[model samples]
Target chain A: MAEFFTNPLVQSVLVPVAGGFILTGAIRFANGRAKGPLVAGAAVALGFLVGYVLIVGLPPLPPVSNQQKLAYVVAGGLIIGFLMDFSRRPPFYRELVYIVGAAAALYWMALPKIAGGTAWTYLSLVALWIAAGLIGYRLEKSRANVVNACAPLLVAALGLGLVALFGRTGSYSQLAFSLATAFGGFMLWNWPIARYPFGATLLLGGAGALVTIAYALALYTEASPYALAMLLLCFFAEPVARRIKLPAGKIGEAFRPVAVGAVALIPALAAVAVAYLTAPGQEAGY
Target chain B: MRTRSIIAGAAALMASTALIGTASAADNYKIDATHTNIIFIVDHLGFSNMIGQFQSFEGNFSFDGKSVEGASVKLTIKTASVDTDHEARDKHLSSPDFFNVQEFPEMSFTSTKFEATGDKTAKMTGDLTMLGVTKPVTLDVTFNKADKFPMDPNVFIAGFSAKGTVNRQDFGMKYAAGAIGDNIGLWIEAEGHKQ
Candidate 1:
C-alpha cells in the first residue's frame, strides 16, 4: 500500500477521485440532493483543490513567484465564481467581469516576462483564448447537456497527453492530471440520462482550467507552441460538431461524442508529431 | 639646521613605509570566463556518474595573503548554459524538471565567511541561490597559485580549485528523484586576473 502511494501515477489519480467523491457527498448533504448549479460549482472548485493539495505534498514545492500566485488566484477564482453565478443569473455582466478579471491577472503575471513585441503577442493570445471560451460556452449552451459534461473529460485527456509528452514528474503536469480525474468523477452524475443542472458552467470552468495550464507551460517551460495551439483548436470542436448533419435517431446520439473526439484528435496528433520531430535531437521511432 | 634635516629625513622614511604597506594590501581579481570552469556530477541510476558543466559564468574575489579571512568571492552562473554534451538531455535538464532556466535564468554564490585551514587551503562558506532557493553551502577550496602571467609580465593571475556537494532536492529540483541521484557533486577550477 505504501509502495503504491509512492508511485506518481497512483498518487495523481487516487487523490482527485477521493476528493471529488468527498466534495460530492458534502454538496449533497448541504443541498439535500446535490442537483443544479451548486453541485457543478462545488465539483469544479473541489477538483482544483485536489490538484493544489497534490502539488503541495509533492516532496519539494516549486518556488512560484508572487506574480504567478496572484495570477492563479485571481484568474481561477474569477472564472469559477463567474461561471457559478452565471448559471443562476445568465447575466451578460458576469461574463464581462470574468473576461476582464482573467485578462488582468494574466497581464500581471506576464509583465515581467514580456518585452516589446512579445507583450503584444501575449495579449493577443489571451484575448483569443477568452474569445474561444465564450464562443465554446455559447455552442455548448445550444447543444444537449451531454456535450457540456463531456468537455471536462476531454480536458482530462489533454492533461494526460501533456504528462506523456512532457514528463509526469513536473508539478504542472501532475496538477493537470488531478484536475482531469476530479472532473471525471463528477461527470458520472452528469450523464446524458441525468439532467444535472449547470452543465454549461462545469464545462466552461473545465475548459478555462485547461487553457490556463497550457499557457503556463508555454510561458515557464520548453513546452512547444504547436501543442498549445492544438489545445486551443479543440475549443472549436463543439461549434463544428453542431454544423454536421447526422441521421436523427439512436445512431446520431452515439455519434455526437465520437465526432467531437475525432475532431479534437486531428490537431492533438499533429501537435504530438510536431513535438516529436522538433524535439532538440531527431531520433528515429520517437 | 642639523635638527631640521633630521626631522625631514624621518618624515621621508614614514612616507615610503606607508607606500609599501598600501602596495602589499589585498589584491582584487576579476574571474576570467575563458579559463574558469564549473562542472557537476550526479549518479545515473547507480550505474555511473553523469557529468555536466556550465559554459558561461563570471565572478570576482578579493584576496589578502596576510588576512585570508578578509577575502571574499562572488560568482554567477548562467543556468541556460548547462551542457551535458548531449543536446536532448541538456534540453530536458534545462526545462522545469531540473534547473527551470526560463523562470530562474541564473544561479549565484556569495561568500559570507572564509576560514584558512592551511597555507594553501581554506573553507569557503556562502549562500548558493539556485531555482530561486537560497541555501548555505561550504566548499573546500585550494589556492592553486598566484603569480605574474608568463605572457604578460605586467598582469597578475590567481587560480583556485573548489569541491562541494549539494542535494538537488534542496533547491526544489525533485523531478526524477529516484531515477537520478539527489546529491550533486560540484568541482570548480577558476583563474582570475588582477583588475
Candidate 2:
C-alpha cells in the first residue's frame, strides 16, 4: 500500500479520476443534476477498469497477418461509440441480461491467439473492435441516446490505437499509454456530457479504449499473467467503494487498481529487459 | 551369342566401377577457413528467432576410396570467434555456458566410424567436445563436388557438409530454461584438399 501510494503510474492514474470526479460534481451541482457528476465519474471509472482487465490478464494474442494493428483500433473505437449511444435509462432486466451475455461472448471471441508479429493480428483486432462498436450500437438503442453511442466507439478506437502502437513494443508502455489515452478521452468527453446527457456512446468509447489497451498490453508484453485480476480490481472499484460508502475522491477508493497496474508493469518490463541482456549463445546460423 | 552378351555386360560393369572408384577417390583435405562457415540459431522470444555464426576456424580431413572403410574427419573451432554482433553475449557464449575457453579451450569433433550410404553420401559418427563434454554425434555427410583448385591446380578441392544436433545440456550447458531452448543445432561445411 505504501509502495502503491509512492509509485508514479499510480499517481498518474488517480490524479485524473479523482480530479475529474470533483470537477464533474461541481458542474452537476450547479446544473441541478447533482447526480450528473457521479454518473460521468462512474462511466470513466468503468471504462478504465474494463480496459485494464482485458489487456493485462490475457495471453499473447495471435497477430493478424494481412493488415496492421490499425484494424483493431478502428473496430474498438466504433464499438465504444456504439455502446456510448446505448447505456442510458431505468434498469431493465432484458438489457442487463443482453449486456452480460455480450460481454461473455466478447471475452470468448478474444481468446484466440492473435500476436503473430504480423499485420493479420492487428487487422483482426480492428475487426473485433468494430464488432464491439456494433454491440455498443445495440446497447445504445435500448437507451435512445446519441452522445453515449459515439463516446464508446471513439474511445474504443483511441484505446485500440494505443494498444496497437505502444502495446506492440512493451508491457509497461502499454499500460502507461492505455491509461493515459482512456483517461484523457474521458475527461474531454465528460465536460459536455455532465451538462447534458450524451448517452451510451461516452461509456462505450471510454470502456472500449480501456479494454483494448489492456488486451493489447497483455498480448504483447509478459507484464502480468493475471492482467484480468488487475482489471477487475479497476472495474469493480467504484461500485465496491460505493457499497462501503467511500467518497468519490478518497485516496483508497481508486488506489487499488492503479497500484496493481503499476506493480505488474514495472517488474515485467525489467525481467524482459534482463532476459534480452543476458541472452546466451551468440552465433547466427546460415 | 547369349554367353558373349553376358560376358560383355559383366566386363562393362567392371570397367565402370573401376573408373568411378579412381575418379571419385578420397584424399586428405584441409578445411579452408576462408570458405567454411559455422553457425547456430535459437528463438529469441516467442516473437522472433536469432542466429550467430563463427567467422573463422581451421581444420583438415582426409580419406581414400581404398580406405573409405577407415575414413576419418576432424575439426577444431576457435572458442573465441563466437559472434552474434553483441560483444558481451559472445563472451558469455565462450564462457561456462558454451565453449568455456578457460577450462576447455578448443572444441574438436573427430569421427570414429564412417559408412558410405550411397554414391555421394555417407554417415560419419564422431565424438564432439565442447565445454569439456564429449558426446557421440552423427553427421549426414554429403560430398558436394571435387575439383582442382583454381589458384593451385596441383591441389584438389573436396567439399562436404556435416549436420547434426547436440544437446547443450549434454555438454554441461544448462542456463536460461524458458528464455533459451536446450537443443543446440550444429552444421559444419568443410573443404579438404590432398595433404
Query: Which candidate has the highest TM-score of all?
Result: 1
C-alpha positional error of residue B68 in candidate 2 after TM-score superposition, expressed in Å:
4.5
Question: Considering every candidate listed, which one attains the maximal DockQ?
Answer: 1
TM-score of each: 0.81, 0.36
Query: lDDT per residue, candidate 2, A55-154, as tens digits?
Result: 3322113322101232244244435434333344443433353344335434433444432336865664555454444444443452232233333333
Q: Write the per-residue lDDT of candidate 2 for residues B1-195, one digit (tens) a residue.
A: 999999999999999998787656756788888778887766664566667887767777877744455678888877778888876566555543345444354788888998888887888999988755578988788878788889989888878787777777566454343456667667777777677
- How is the predicted docking of candidate 1 categorized under the CAPRI scheme? acceptable
Q: Which window of 10 residues has the lowest lDDT sum in candidate 1 chain A? A: A58-67
True contacts kept of 2: 0.00
Model 1 Cα lDDT, one tens digit per residue, A36-132: 3344445654665555544433333222542135225523553655455445555354455445645655564454476554766767666645654
Mind giving the per-residue lDDT tens digits that candidate 1 earns over B102-151? 77889999999999999899999999999788999999999988999999
True contacts kept of 1: 0.29
Best by lDDT: 1
In candidate 2 the C-alpha lDDT for residue A274 amounts to 40
Q: Cα miss at B47, model 1 (Å)?
A: 3.4
